[model samples]
Target: MNNLIIETLSWGKLEVTEEQIYYFSKGIPGFDEETELALIEMAESPFWYLQSIKNEGLSFLLGDPFIFYPSYEFELPDNEAEELQIGSNVVVRCIITLKEQVEQSTINLLAPIVLNPDGNVGKQIVLHRSPYHTKHCLLQEQPAIDGKDGG
Candidate 1:
């Protein structure tokens, strides 16, 4: 119980110190009770998945929405910003949609779970925008791979 152990692809039993774990207040939708989460690299994938040790079976795929959608941007309502203490030190991230094919994947840019990595505080704020969807398809075009072909 000394360190937060998260299973990862590259680093086995990804040990995250208590100081490194972030607390998601209000948790993800339909999972409000799951407060604590540890972010670890998705084994052999470009995404980072949040693991809820308390729930065991609960976990979500997360990533920098901007990584895929460089133009991706959103505003957290005043209430959410105040609740999360999203000061200048916080970082914003979104959950990516899981697809059978990697190219068909999409990130939830409309609702991002902003986190204050330094303070271990977080909240998922929804963006009431029509241009973006909760399930936007990723990679509209086939991205060129320099070395390995698969994503």
Candidate 2:
């Protein structure tokens, strides 16, 4: 492709290459038009953001759950495994919902976005039966926005 464009909910414009684009078999329900996406840097810190190159301005902040919360773990459904061609034990990330309090920031653990890098398939798989909530406090309580570890 000559021109691959991506739009973000925040960041406006960004150019993407064929290799950078990812395909999600069951495309994001709300955003069906956005079939291609690329993960990129947000600022100059320990945070990364995923931007939709197909849309005008749509992006979400993402991070490794294990990095912040070590006990994070999820089970992939059988059908999802077959769809994504999941190889070995892999993981999908969730778009964190940050609060002004910083420490109050929470992540959607129940429905983490799962993807298979090898298959280029991604999807937000919802956990129908689980104790996990939609908003799991990242730090359990108020931490700090020092742009460092939540300590």
Candidate 3:
């Protein structure tokens, strides 16, 4: 198995397998210069870190959007599916912006990181004409029941 050593701001040097490295042909939205990234899974957690192999400081904290928004759903365009050469297996993750108050944290649902694990390729897909936005609260607010006194 081929392994690679990558530098990260948070985790320092990490030894990752070749399979962990994902190639982004068009690069991510803001950081278009970075084409290669490593998807590092956080142990015992639903979150994952998308670390740029070339730039140690460039990384994103990603989370499973469905886990936070149980009702979240979206249709992948045929052209996008074809662009990634996606098969039956595909992984989706959203960038998370953590705040001092955890409840205030937000996730970017407008643009999601879609990966083709089999092909080791990924793309940040921006949803068009969608209800989702860039800053959706990571934690869902609890609904209050009608103010009714139980006799």
Candidate 4:
């Protein structure tokens, strides 16, 4: 329950507190055997690394999808909500896939990793009824202040 030293493949040795650990009872999709995860905040950025304690090499780049898609929304199925025992305070994060160009990165909008900050429980739930796709372009042309794209 105290600060534990975690050996990660990418970040090397890190001293993380109990509050940074997330427990996934059913584990994550594709990596069902991994139940213990830790959130490693990126340096001076909105992105984070979701690392699997079971496998030091297993890690993911995550970000708050809302930062890009303000209107993005989804409903957690009743069963999943009950599984995490989470209410309105749950934190939702999406995975990012970097392309050859950083501007061409994509985000997985179909499945989101939900974390119950209060209980330290989390789950990666696939949204079958979502209107979004798994690979949404992470970077798009920004609309100009004058109402026209500054292309």
Per TM-score, the best of the predicted structures is 3
**Per-residue lDDT over 22-118 for candidate 4, one digit per residue giving the tens place of the 0 to 100 score:** 9988888888898999988888887999988768799999988999788889989999999899977899999999878777799898999999999
lDDT of 1: 0.75
Q: In terms of TM-score, how similar is model 3 to the real structure?
A: 0.92
lDDT value, residue 19 of candidate 2: 55
Cα RMSD of all models vs. native, in order, equals 5.5, 5.5, 4.8, 4.3
Cα lDDT for residue 86, candidate 4: 90
- Candidate order by TM-score, highest to lowest? 3, 4, 1, 2
- CA shift at 55, candidate 4, in angstroms? 1.6
When 2 and 4 are scored with TM-score, the better candidate is 4
TM-score of each: 0.78, 0.77, 0.92, 0.88
Candidate 2, 69-90: lDDT as tens digits: 6787767889988887889746
Q: Any residue pairs clashing in model 4, and if so which? A: none
Clashing residue pairs in candidate 2 are 5-53, 6-53, 7-55, 7-56, 7-58, 8-57, 8-58, 9-57, 9-58, 9-59
Clashing pairs counted in every model: 0, 10, 0, 0
Candidate 1: tens digits of C-alpha lDDT, residues 68-125: 7888766677887788776788777788777898887877877788888768887777
Off by over 4 Å in 4: 142-151
Off by over 4 Å in 1: 6-13, 42-46, 142-151
CA error at residue 24 for candidate 4, angstroms: 1.2
Worst 10 residues of 4 by lDDT: 139-148
Q: Rate the local accuracy (lDDT) of all candidates.
A: 0.75, 0.72, 0.94, 0.88
